[model samples]
Target chain A: MIKVLFFAQIRDQLATSELRMPSSENHNIEMLLSNLKARDSHWQTVLSKTNLLVAVNQTISNENSALQSGDEVAFFPPVTGG
Target chain B: MIKVQTTDFNLQAEHDKLREKSSVGAVVTFSGLVRDINQGKEVSSLTLEHYPGMTEKSLTKIVEQAKSRWNIIDCTVIHRIGELKLSDQIVFVGIASLHRQDAFAACEFIMDYLKTEAPFWKKESTTDNESYWVDAREGDLKALNKWSK
Candidate 1:
């Protein structure tokens, strides 16, 4: 399974912090995002944000990054702390 | 040392610790405070959120980079989470080095990187009872760029 997490405003808007889904061959962040977007219009709207940031295995990553079983993924907004 | 905690930290203690090395001749410290006003709004309180594992990793990477670029003897970074009131201390960075220039440069370098790289978010509550997440500033991205050149 792939563990997906959300934080900050994205988490507040979605009201869902974590999710788990089965991993498949040739899976990547973009495909996972599309699967998530298919859940509902609200998910579609929030996940489609242009400024949204993603992380794979605790490192900053882009949508093209590949995923594997038991990998952790996160989605959130840009950081504002010092 | 890197610390991400909800409790307040003592500046003097951090300074003394950083200066413990006999070869250290300079210690520079930077602290960030919660402001009473932001973007024309009267802020009363602020709350911070962070990606647990990634926050530490990012900070360590930034400190490592600073060490590689400068002659740093020691460094300490402390970032506060949870709710904080106006004027409360939010973050602290201290660097020890053999000379003033290295300490000063490394201190600023860590702060600049932390502002852009660390996965931390701040939410502010205004005096009028309105609360919102603070937006990332363009100036912060610019600050990080200056170091790369």
Candidate 2:
């Protein structure tokens, strides 16, 4: 399983902070996102935001980044911290 | 040093700690306060939320990057989470170096990158009881690009 994390506005919108996804196939970040979006309409709408940001293992990541079991993935809006 | 805490920090104590090394000659500190107003709205308070483990890791990396790019002697980053009142201190970035320019540049670099790369969100509560998530500004992303080239 891979650890999926949600932060900031995404967390508030989805009403969750983290969850575990079953490991299957050679899914990349994009695939992971699509899978999450399939959960419900609320997930679909919130995850589909144009400005959505992602990270893999604490590093900023993109859709093409491949995922592996045990990896920690994060999704959030663009940061506004100082 | 990097800390993610809900409690407010002491600026003078943080400065004293950063400047303790004899090699340090210049110290630069930047403190961010929760403002009373934003975008013409009277904000009553702000709720700062962050991913716990990742927030510290991201902050440490930012400080490491700053150390690599400049001749900084030491650095401290403290970010507060949870509810904060108007005008309350929210964040602090302090750098100590042998020269003023490096300290200044490193301090600014950390702040800029922290705003873009860190996983933090601010929700502002207006005086009228309406609360909204603060959107990331275009200018923040632009500020980070200045450091890349």
Candidate 3:
């Protein structure tokens, strides 16, 4: 399972917070995003913007980056990180 | 020394902590404040957020980098977190070195890198009933690139 993290106002709005989903060899970050948006309407609203950043582990990730088992996926609005 | 805390810090006291006996002839500091306005948005307060463990670790590394790159005597960095009001002091960086040039240059260098490399995030709450996360400014990233080792 892959670990997904959250932060900011996004974290403020969460209920259960963080998740572990079955890892798939064929699915990349783009697919994971699509799956997340499909499962949760809240995610759809927060991430509908194309600018949302995806980080595999702690580093900013490319859309096409492949997901590996035990990877941590963090999806947040374009990192306003200072 | 470096600290990331929610308590408001005394600028002078923190500075004095680094004033121990040594050959250091210069001391420099940089403070970041929560301003009243930004691009016409009337900001009433600011909140600084950071990844707890990662932030302290990154800051320690940054201070070490400065020590290696300059002939410095002492350094102190204190950053405030949680809720802060308008004109409230948010962050402070202090550097002491043998010469003023190294002190000034390294202080700016640390500030610039802290702005970009550190995992801290700022959100501006305005009187107009809007809250938005401050975007990482392009100029800040550019500033760090200029001093890239």
Question: Which candidate's lDDT is highest?
Answer: 1
lDDT score of residue A36 within candidate 1: 93
- What fraction of the reference interface contacts is present in each model, in order? 0.82, 0.84, 0.33
Write out the backbone clash pairs for model 1. Answer: none
Better structure of 1 and 3 per TM-score: 1
In the range B17-36, model 1's lDDT, one tens digit per residue, is 99898999999999999999
Clashes of 1: 0
Q: For model 1, how does the per-residue alpha-carbon lDDT over A12-47 read when each residue is reduced to its tens digit?
A: 999999989779832999999999998899999999
Interface RMSD of 3: 2.8
- The runs of at least 3 residues in candidate 1 whose Cα sits more than 4 Å from the true structure, single-residue gaps closed, are none
Best by TM-score: 1
State TM-scores per candidate. Answer: 0.98, 0.94, 0.80
RMSD of 1: 0.9
lDDT of 3 by residue, B1-149 (tens): 88888988887887786667478788898888888987679998888877665567667878888888887888988888898998888889998888899999889878877876666778889998799877667787688777765
lDDT of 2: 0.91
What's model 2's lDDT at B134?
91
What local distance difference test score does each model get?
0.94, 0.91, 0.76
TM-score of the second chain, cand. 1: 0.99
Docking class for candidate 2: high
